[model samples]
Target: MRLKVLTCLVAVAALYAPQASAGSKIRVETRTYDVTGASGIELIQNINRKGPKRGFMAHAIALTAYSASWDLVMLRRNGSCRVRQANGTMDLVFTFPRVVSPMSPALKRRWSRFMAGTHAHEATHGRLARDMMRAAERSAVGLETTDDPSCSKARREAGRRIEAVSAQYEAKQKAFDVTEHRGGGHVEHLVLALIKP
Candidate 1:
């Protein structure tokens, strides 16, 4: 029920600490949304309607959006250019429905379990995003180009390396989704619990 949106942002022009001494750093940003309804079932239905759509499925109990960007600083010395700093950042926005107030003990218990399961799944996706960002940063680090006229060649190579890393991680994310969301998987179990309770 919790789905994640991934965005790969363009290079940003910002001064970051030198990578030679400081190494790479990753920044994570997060946001949350709340939806409310009269009861738990209503809450679920409302959230499903309001959540983001993926492919043909328009209903989701929760959703997470992850946007990542990187800044690469190049240093030129002695007719050679090298990546001096690689800084990566990611933003994770999680949207979920609020548990209805004044619920019966049984309903409250089920709601609690549902929230826990959904959050856990979304957190895993967030972790994967962060990991991919870090990998991209590492790939961008230390890239060099000896082309004399301009560093465009080096820049292009660095971009390709970073993109390759990102693509590989993206494939991993898809594979994980397929495994985790297969029939009778973790997500299905969570949904069944919420509805059958």
Candidate 2:
């Protein structure tokens, strides 16, 4: 009886050991948007899905920069992928609920911009999240050594690069907003401006 109980306990411990070890890993959630109508729910869903990619990517890079900070990753992507209504106004606009995090003030600012960048920026977050998750998984599986200083440095560098790209995206967003409000009526230019640097 003692031997059987000990074996059962060992098996249970083995089953849970990996789970306990991986508790610190980040979680990521991604949503894709395709709105077929102008329904309010559909519009909100579309915007929410599209608005967070760049910000999320920026957030990831920030985490990599510090080599700390673990939290779930959320990415929203897809742009104002609709055409002008017959009434000649924006067919749709996107809005995502603000996220509150314990990140530093600087990180918070970057995250806000990233969240506010063009819808396409969300796609960047999706890509970055995948890459980060893969790296984390590899480390967890023992394929990569987390303790390597080189690994830490590489992550920091990658974070910085992503931030630079995000900044450009932000600037373009600002420019587009300006041109849009001026009644320039340049649809193609506005779309291009949103996604391009």
Candidate 3:
């Protein structure tokens, strides 16, 4: 009976081994950036309101945009960005302060500016991450063959694309700095911003 069980195990392993070998190994890392302040909640809320088309929101707009385009998973709040490596994952956390009242229209305008800038900044990181994963995936496949000029060329092209996209995103995000109060204030307005990727 023991021999039969062992044989069955071996058979199962053999049957699944090829498929497992063909599948690429995936690892994920996340990084969080905190944008804390008295207007942090309002900032996040405004950013979320921009949606995907605006190209300035963090959740679905930035995360989904990159993930869908680059074949990477934009994990929500501690979600993982899967890579074809075993080096675990990176987590990025962004913290911000609470909102207070006495917010004037002028303050709201400033908040809007802040949100737009923050979204642009975070989107750059997202783009970089996506590019990195794509490069890794290509490397995994490229290492297997020798004298495959086509594959090598493709990999090189992919690298260039990644670099270009990363630079563009980074430049856009870094262009604006947060110019507002950091903390301290009473809760005049409470906007519940959903915690998502």
Tens digits of per-residue lDDT for model 1, 24-65: 444444444455654566667766766656558675666666
- Please, what is the whole-model Cα lDDT of each candidate in the order they appear? 0.66, 0.30, 0.32
Q: Work out the TM-score per prediction.
A: 0.80, 0.24, 0.33
Top candidate when judged by lDDT against the true structure: 1
Ranking by lDDT: 1, 3, 2
Say which prediction, candidate 1 or candidate 2, comes out ahead on TM-score: 1
The regions of model 1 sitting more than 4 angstroms off are 1-41, 55-57
Better of 1 and 3 by lDDT: 1
Model 2 per-residue lDDT at 30: 33
Report clashes for each candidate as comma-separated counts: 0, 5, 19
Native-referenced Cα lDDT, model 3 = 0.32
Better TM-score candidate (1, 3): 1
How far in Å is the alpha carbon of 42 misplaced in model 2? 24
* Per-residue lDDT of model 3, residues 102-150, tens digit only: 5556556665654454455454454544454444444433222234323
